[model samples]
Target: MIDLRSDTVTRPSAEMRRVMFEAPVGDDVWGDDPSVTHLEHYLAERTGKAAALFLPSGTQSNLVALLSHCQRGDEYLVDQQAHTYRLEGGGAAVLGGIQPQPLDGLNTGELPLAKLKAAIKPVDPHFARTRLLTLENTFHGQVLDADHVAQTTALAREQGLATHLDGARIGNAAAASGSSLEALCAPFDTVSICCSKGLGAPMGSVLVGPEAFIATATRWRKVVGGGLRQVGSMAAACEYALDHHLPQLIQDHEKAERLAAGLAAIDGITVTAQATNMVFVAFEDSAFAPEPLHAWLAEQGILVGALYAPRFVTHRDVSMADIDQVVAAFRDYFQRLTR
Candidate 1:
């Protein structure tokens, strides 16, 4: 099946697998794993953070950051639709006793600084203490404006609120924006970056922040079962992706543009948004039922979300030829529907 479901589904390349096979391993719980140590150091330096920790997944990475940043009853403000707040199974609330104040955000996933300022609870005992303001880059494949982020982080700092960034797709953001990785991560106090996403690693996420904060996150990681032994295999794959596949993300973004352009010409479909390896298409008419189109595409081995404005993701495994085939399948489906 042509899995446009998510970038997370991409398998590791042979070169990455070779590196994993030859990887040097050690006990990470004792802080001696060479591969994990190398990955953490590389991510920290690249993001300009004082330190970094390798976690099993993005969910754990974000959870550790949340646990480190906020205490029990302390609230972290986040976009209502962001992965950290809406997804991640409410780990912060359930496991850490940290509350998330989910707030309205723009389609680009930017929370208004004014709204954020207003949301910060006054020291009154009646409200949960607002401890952190979290933001997501490449929110639904839409990159947040750098100026907006700079201003928001500055405001948060002035208000004595710590800032965290859930940058599960920061490489995509960097690729699309022509910004350095460090430049993208410079504003926030903590960032959770996923290698398993568009980077094409089989699994791994690196959380970067201050040394003291990472120490705190390290403790949280252990409590949450992220302290794995001889995790070098996955760590090696992530490092391989960072070294080789990071630059190819532009091709993924370009293919998304191509897919969007092709889908826009279809009668019943509207390409609502396109950026950084993902396309969000909407049904032009409410009468245009999605089930038939989905079924037809599925028969052709083309996969997409089962919704009106379904999202299509492009990744390392999807080529230009695959993009054309997907477009053709979409065109054929619409053509048959019109018949």
Candidate 2:
């Protein structure tokens, strides 16, 4: 089946598998895994950070970053819709005792500066001290403006708060916006880069920050049961993705644009948003049932997101030919409605 559910669904390519098989292995929990160390160093240099730590998932990476930046009872400012605050299972609050001060964000995924300034609690015993300000790039596939990111993060510094970026899809943001990874990351003190997403690695995320902060995160990672043994193969796969698949992100974004344009031309479908490698579409009429379309598309050897909101993600495994087929399938589904 042609899966458009998410980029995370991508399996390792034959080349990546070969690298994983040949990778030199050692116990990562002991900091002796050469492959894991290589991956960490590569990402650290690319993002211009002093050091990096490899974690099992983006969730853990973000959680560790939060734990390193904030102490118990301290809070962080984040957008209400940010993946770190809303989607990461609240690990910061549950595990680190860190509170989240969620503010509504603009369409570009930027926190309104006025509201952000007003939200920072003054020095008092009554409020949770704001310790960090977190931001996300490529929020719902829309790239956050670089200028806005600089401004918000600068404001964060002015208020004496540290900054972290849930850059799970930072590569996509860089590819789409024509910005360098280091340039995009310069505003924040720490960043979590997920290789499992558009990079097409089977699994792995690297958290990059200062050496001292990474040392702190390493301890939290161990405390949270993230200290894996012999993960060299996974690290090798992520390295392979960084070397081979990063350029393909631009092609994925192009395919998403193509798919969005095709669906928009259909009579009953509305293209609600398109950015990077993700496109969201919806039926023009709320009364329309999507169950039939889901079943029909499945019968045609196609798969999409199971959620009520229709989101299609283009990835390395999805080709231009496959994108055309998906567009035809959607068009055919709607054409049958009029008949």
Model 2 ranges with Cα > 4 A deviation: none
Per-residue C-alpha lDDT of model 2 across residues 1-339, encoded as one tens digit per residue: 999999999989999999999999999999999999999999899999999999999999999999999999999999998899888899999988999999988866889999999999999999999899999887999888888888998898999999999899998998888888899888899999999988988899999999999999999999999999999999999999988888779999999999999999999989999999999887888899988899999999999886488899999899999999998998898889999
* Cα lDDT for residue 331, candidate 2: 85
Best by TM-score: 2
User: Best candidate, lDDT-wise?
Assistant: 2
- In model 2, which range of ten residues has the least summed lDDT? 303-312
Clashes of each: 0, 0
Candidates in order have lDDT scores of 0.91, 0.92
Tens digit of lDDT per residue, candidate 1, span 100-190? 9989988688888788899999999999999999999889998989999999999999999999999999999989999998999999999
Query: How much is the lDDT of residue 310 in candidate 2?
Result: 89
